[model samples]
Target: MIVSNVSLSGCAGANSALCAAVGDGHQGGGSYRSTLSPTGNLVVAVCLGFIGTFGLLNNLLVLILFCRYKMLRSPINLLLINISISDLLVCVLGTPFSFAASTQGRWLIGEGGCMWYGFANSLFGIVSLISLAVLSYERYSTMVVPTEADASNYRRISQGILLSWLYSLAWTLPPLFGWSKYGPEGPGTTCSVDWTAKTANSISYIICLFLFCLITPFLVIVFCYGKLLCAIRQRKYRKFLAALQYVFGLTE
Candidate 1:
């Protein structure tokens, strides 16, 4: 159903599911509105509820485990805790409104709420992705160097975590400043970076976000893990060769 205040003229003749022109009271320009049926909205609400609940509990468990166990507080594992924190924030700050909107079959909050949801989710999600990349690199470093110094390198770990958050924040803020925008996304239940806007600024922001925030982190994770696998295989191979040589020498 269209927002009560939103005019039918703007979204007229457009597919309800795909329409993004529904104007809200707060946003004189327009915002997205879901035209989904009641059953569909119920399904969406149920799914969001499940995901939000499960994610919140799971991440909270991770944080609790890390905090309770001193051995789990290693410089490397701190990255995992960072990821958990970001996930937990997403569940807390982002999921509830979406869940509420889904239950109501439209965005319950106004434009300001939409923008806040979009920015908050994007920031936290990007933080989680960057943290994963950093964690992979940390693992690769441990495997490759295996140094006592690196194992206890709390300073390095802190720097990595700080960089992950700062880098994610840097990218997510541009939308707020009008580099692109943050608005309602699919089904109008959630909000995110505006992907449909074709303006130069919006297009540029999307391209940069895709490359730097997403692609860069993905490539880092792949490269680090690839090198790690190679190192492990080589170590195993050497161990096998040593075992074979010992067996032959004993036989001789």
Candidate 2:
């Protein structure tokens, strides 16, 4: 839960804070970099720093456990490890710069760094999503189809993790190649693919990214988890019925 809160809050709040800062600056006009006095910016930096530190420590501990224990080396654990990698990257690569930018009241990384940061942020976010969906599917398979055949699928799951990273990378690069462009996102606190742009290419990229990267994995995780819960209940109910029959001497 700590891991989830820290990772998700950092990811969501980082972006949302930019939008919030923008709104604060322009009073609904949505201008950039005019919001937040120096003190406000410092407060934001302090908050982000705390969030990033907590998340980084938790994820690092998990990684340390994974590396330290041979028993922790399994397909499901690998999926979790991959997820941790993404969150850890978010903590290390994304967080401090956000703190610096927030406190400094503008992007200090220049244009190219801004683009890289945007791409990296998008990449890490997508990787985390894909990792979660894959983990959900693994859990579903384990619960409903715990067979030798399913056990053999471990290699494929690991391969899927690798593929997901590549998939995330592929989508993040389109902006660099001009499908859309990375620009100051909301109050200039961070850089990302300019979602508010009115260009056709920008709209197309946004739609595709939403559908493929975000929506697909989200639906997969939700569906798989729901199915998993139902399966467990069904299994337990069957066991309950069997116990009742055995006690009542009603053999079939």
Best by lDDT: 1
**TM-score of each model, paired residue for residue:** 0.89, 0.83
Per-residue accuracy of model 2 over 31-148 as CA lDDT, tens digit each:
2352568887888899989989998999999999999998887778888888889999999998888788888786666556667788899999999988898889888988886755
lDDT of 2: 0.79
Off by over 4 Å in 1: 1-21, 26-32, 149-152, 250-252
C-alpha positional error of residue 78 in candidate 1 after TM-score superposition, expressed in Å: 0.7
User: Which clashing pairs does model 2 show?
Assistant: 33-187
- Report lDDT (Cα) of residue 23, candidate 1: 51
Q: Which residue pairs in candidate 1 collide?
A: none
